[model samples]
Target: MNESIKKVAVIGTGVIGNGWIARFLSQGYEVTAFDPAAGAEERTRLAVNHAWPSLEERGLAANASKDRLFFKDDLAEAVSGADYIQENVPEREELKKSVLHTIDQHARMDALIGSSTSGIKPSILQSDMIHPERFFVAHPFNPVYLLPLVEVVGGEQTNKKALEQAGRFFSSIDMKPLTIHKEIDGHVADRLMEALWREALHLVNDGIATTEEVDKAIIYGAGLRWAQMGPFLTFHLAGGEQGMRHMLEQFGPALKLPWTKLKAPELTEELKERVISGCEEYAGDQSVSDLEAKRNEFLVKLLALVEEYWPEESQAKANI
Candidate 1:
């Protein structure tokens, strides 16, 4: 465990898993990736190629290169010598449990295994693992190569030392790991996001707004501030020097008003079609790959800006 991680294993080659492999390789780790899905290797190669430009702009490590990635058909062979393992299998409870248990049998006992699960609790996924203490959640946002935030949540059987080790390793790869003190299904970011998603779906289902309109509401408003400071801190500034207390006092009464729908509307065929068509309209003539490249480039610049300005607030608070 004291040794530096030279090799990492990625358990799936889907979007999340592909991103992880690219991120790891960009940070100079030799990565061995395995997926049971047909054409997974080809998809992984294309995904890595598509994401490499952003990583290069962001700056890669001394040894970082796409050539460092290896594909393995056998799961055990993929993880055999890896110092760390990231599981990006589909988010099904029993499926994750089974996959994790199987991985546990092959991977080095000391290697920390993390799930890129967006919502599933780690305790359940690690239930059948031989060394549950080394298994935890390392949930990263999409386009993992560009995003710095990664949620690190440990299960009931997870060891604190193992979590610390994993967090340190993730940090070394330039990720900001937020270690959740208590386990939650969606962790922190996703829970807030799910609420906003449900509200947006309600808006669309009620014919109040199109998907593009909902997106504009975010891209032009709070999303800008959110890149630097979180909602709580941003609202504290809205208090006009009285801080969050005044902000809460002024806006607290509005909480009783039914301004939003908490429950999501059912995804009926009409709703699905509306959403799908709206997305198509938003895309216009751009293919999925085209849109993804644009998004990644914007995110790379945005994250760089955040990294530059984000520390100012912290320094100012410290001066106070």
Candidate 2:
């Protein structure tokens, strides 16, 4: 694929949309953004500016041209002649359906349309679209320019060509694109993350650990391994010379132990209060921006390390 990715359109200039803009702009794509909310353009510009320095620090934005970003009040104007269209609207089903419908009506037939939806499946969201085949999920984690994992999920009506095109497009921008085999609620990463979040909430509710301690348990333990490799790969390493088979044989019995609760905990008020309080206490001095900057910094370094360790294979897959 060519390194050039000119004329990308971003809908909904919120946090995720802003990140998408940054990623595209850093990759030398001329970004045209549309957002109905007032002051959305200013917010997007601020996000792009803030992200620029971080991208520069990581050497990803070197030799990349700037001033290719454009903002528009009209969605159709943004989508016209766009090479790729990324929709990052609110998570409401009706809102997404409406925006996609409009995009389907206005966007060029060949332009790829992707959603940053976290939980909503593309089938339901793109049900009202005239060209659902051109639509698919390109879900990215928060602060999209830094993180490299973009879950690419296709709906029932989503075409194979579109998925392939999207996969290629993300790769051009140095993103890791994981094509989900089937549509599942919350997709892959979010489903696994939600499970962990539920358990964390349960532990807090049970007074087992504070939010900070729980966070430390992850950052100090498996999270370090996960930064370089996933759970299965880590287990494969844990197996020593024998591999996963040996590891499983040795620890399979632990699965029977009461180690984790797979069931989700009910969001009762008392439990919610405990979780909220714990988080607030943990987040005391740092503002959201401060924490996000720290996270972006860490993610940039971590992904760069992964790229260095397993350059060929990992670089071909990971996208944010």
Candidates in order have lDDT scores of 0.90, 0.85
Candidate 2 residues lying further than 4 Å off, grouped into runs, are 1-5, 60-66, 311-320
Top model number, TM-score = 1
lDDT of predicted model 2: 0.85
Pairs with backbone N, CA or C atoms under 3 Å apart (clashes), candidate 1: none
lDDT of 2 at 296: 76
Once superposed on the true structure, which residue ranges of model 1 sit more than 4 Å away at CA?
312-320
lDDT of 1 by residue, 70-172 (tens): 9998999999888899999998888888888888999987888999999998888888888899889999998898888899999999989988998889889
CA RMSD of each candidate after superposition: 2.1, 2.8
Q: Could you tell me every candidate's TM-score relative to the true structure?
A: 0.96, 0.91
Best by lDDT: 1
